[model samples]
Target: MNRWMRPLVWAALLGTSVAGAQGIELLPGTPRPLDIRAASPCTFVTVMNRGTTPATLEGEWVNGVNSVPVAFDAPAVPMCEAAGTALTPIQPQRARTVRVKVNSAALGTLLGRRSVLEGHLVLRAAQGGPAILTPLAVEKPSLLGRTGVQRLLWPFVLACLFILGVALRVRRALGQEMFAAEWAPEKSWGSNLALITGLITTVGGVTKIAESVTPLVTLTGVVFTLLGLAAPLLYRATLHSLAAHPDRQAGPVWGYLLASLLTLWGAFGGLITLGALLDSLANRLSGTSDDLLGTLVMVLTFLIVLAVIVFSWQRLVQNIDEQLVAAPKRHRQSALL
Candidate 1:
């Protein structure tokens, strides 16, 4: 503790505080620069404009000590890819997330073992203003798994269960003579297509959890997504047509069970698959940001459809239980006679 150096330290700290307060403030909860082991390294950071006027950000990643420009992925922010520049406009006092993906090779060289690579994210105002510098650091851990393959496995499992449910429903429905007799004519093609598409959608969704979507995956997903949405209507039409025919006396128990299974499964599973597809599209169009309004509408529709299906299923189950109870009583009454 040199007496002369102590005063200078206070002045430097005070100046740093004033500069931070004046310019863009890195929002709280912004992720610390992550350790990179994967070939493609990405991280999310948020910033707030504290200035009175509206400001746009023009970002650059630079080596902190030598001040050399570091090549990195551009259009880092989601949903604000406005034309030529990678500039993101922020209303004063508002916060926005900026996605940063640095070149792994360049970053690796700068980061040796025990080498803490410090850098600066320089955000210049779109209107030719002085840059705001935010310090950055990242560890080069040997392995990184933040892509969340493990987390996505749950959804893949759900999708698989949904597929199994659909298959069982199809098998049960086909076992009915009435349904089997009518099935092969007009509706067979659509049903087969639906099955194929459903499988593709499920497989594609699982793949998406691990890897990027290729054109083949996208195309198959599109077909599968469309069929998933349409399969319910096809089921409804077939069921209604069968119910209208008097000659088709598919026993009540089997009919009701299959109907309940198919209707509930179609509505519930269809919505889940549809949501996944739409989410994929939304992500592609708007980076990782959500489509809030679209999601709200989908959620509401799902609730309504789910409520109707559950009510119908409960009623069918109740009726089946009543018939079972009455059948035992009738048999006992006949024995007494």
Candidate 2:
């Protein structure tokens, strides 16, 4: 046989002997129980033997307390003959049972009702050397507590809001005749201003979405901001186009300006709200409260912005109505002249 093959054959023979000699594998056995009456002790059973040559087996269980180690007494059976004065050398195919008795105090320290046990098992070679087959573990007690919230709520809410927003915008866009108009030089100036405001608001909304740590409320803020900014820009463009045509009557420029301002206000408010929400979520996750003052400032900013949007929106609507009513009389006079 080749040199590599010789070691492989020897390892196979050793494995066969070890398997035959194993009366009970410790890992497969039931662990010693915990949480009995205060005075009750615990018991564990295991078996071990050398595979190829004679070897002595010795072990001790270490409880979690600071007490000295306790060793197990040898069993009465002499299944394998002694190799020397040291101890019995376990032969290739022989096996023996080993029992461990743990005192109540040790059991309490090692495996309490609600506490965890942490330790290791070691196996030593007979030629006076280091050990093998060391297994370590941390045992946990049964748990009891709340499991927390369901994961599906946020996604469902977002889907509903998205659908609602899209439907409303689409209905307005398709049914309204307000969007078809020719562009005029004077009206273009107002549209450009609205466009600038819309761009700023869009940037703020994107920032909010990017920082969304809490889904529903933060996402709501982002969407509202984006829509608010977009509405004014759309209105401005449509009005400018209509007024540019000599035959068409454009609404007052001030109404569109006020609308744009409201949209921008609403968007900025939303950005602040979402940013505050994200800061709060971060604090909760990390178990720290460093940004409490910043959060309060953000809340205050949102409130002020909300008030501005509401006021501006009302004013813009009233102005637009007045402008629309007066435009026709002005157009008629111009035609007669």
Query: What ranges in model 2 sit over 4 Å off?
Result: 1-233, 236-269, 272-274, 277-287, 326-337
> lDDT by residue for model 2 over 1-337, one digit each (tens)?
5643532443353342221233322334544433222222223344444355555555434323322232333445422221113335555444544433333344434431123343433334435433322223333221110010111233224324433443343343223332222234344322333334344434544554333233444344444545454554565554544545666545344334434434443444344443444444444554543445534545564575456445534543333333343332122111000
Displacement of the residue 229 alpha carbon in candidate 2, Å = 6.5
What are the RMSDs of all candidates, in order?
Answer: 17.0, 22.2
Candidate 2 yields a Cα-based lDDT of 0.37
Residue-level lDDT tens digits of model 1 in 1-337: 5644533443353233322445566665534664454454555666777778877655555553433333222343342222223534677888777665555665555522122355555555556544545566654421111233422333344434544544454443334322211233243332343454456555766567422333433444454445434544443444433355554422333443443343344334434444444444554565432346435545654575456445543443334433332142122110000
lDDT of 1: 0.44
Task: Rate residue 264 of model 2 by lDDT.
Answer: 45
Point out where model 1 deviates above 4 Å: 1-266, 276-292, 322-337
Worst 10 residues of 1 by lDDT: 328-337
The all-Cα superposition gives candidate 1 an RMSD in Å to the true structure of: 17.0
Best by TM-score: 1
lDDT of 1 at 261: 43
